[model samples]
Target: MSFEERDHTADILMHIRAADTIGLFTDAGHALMKTMYRGPARPIEEVSVTITGQSLEHLLHGFLSELLFESEVQNIVFCEFEFQIRDGEVRAILRGEPFDPAIHGGGTEVKGISWYGLSIRQEQNEYACDVLFDV
Candidate 1:
């Protein structure tokens, strides 16, 4: 489903489930979908997160990595996420704060989100994806 056409809760759940499935095989990835508000978008806030999916690892890493990408590239906090996962690919509409040294990670730099070490396959009506985060 498109980010605009998805149910927030369902999208988050799917991402989590996908991450969890990956965790079952290995602990090298995370999945997250969130939309930030209060900063640029309306009704969203910083330090806010909505976790979905049954995959814990994917949810965690995906959230953080997306945050990392925002901080470094966009110089935003991106505390909120509007998430959708389809065919193993996650589409997120993120909103958060601008770069602040206080919230930034120390001595840790996120390389990027990689298609490597990951897979997305269709399983009936649902899409399954295993993604690896580059830390």
Candidate 2:
């Protein structure tokens, strides 16, 4: 799995490529966390989220949105994710620690995940998509 930050006129854009659905979610989650928080020396807490969508694209949006919600409501930064995807639903276990300004360097405050320019496709053995985050 791999991801790169793309140039956007406003907000942040990320393009992710993975070999499977689970890998895609894992990479996207890590990319989002890295964009907002530096990291914690060690994980101190865990969060679990389950989301269902009508399609793969919607599922991706829901996954990212849930991550954003957890960050804001819990005041934490997630670093690890283990998830399973089946029938347009995702059940995930995320591990991280409460955000500490001193340890987890601050970055752009992502407001929300946007569907603009969103795309999800399968090419040969890989799945790829572009995600836009409102900042």
Write one digit per residue (lDDT tens) for candidate 1, span 15-58. Answer: 22223332322222222222321223232444433445444335
lDDT by residue (1-135, candidate 2, tens digit) is 499999999888999999988889888888788788875535678989999999988888999999999988998888888888889798988888888898888677888899987788898999898898888
TM-score of each: 0.38, 0.94
Tell me how many clashing residue pairs each candidate has.
25, 0
Which regions in candidate 1 have their CA more than 4 angstroms from the true location?
Answer: 1-70, 83-92, 121-128
TM-score computed on alpha carbons, candidate 1: 0.38
Q: For each candidate, C-alpha RMSD in Å?
A: 12.4, 1.3
Model 2 accuracy (lDDT, Cα): 0.87
TM-score of 2: 0.94
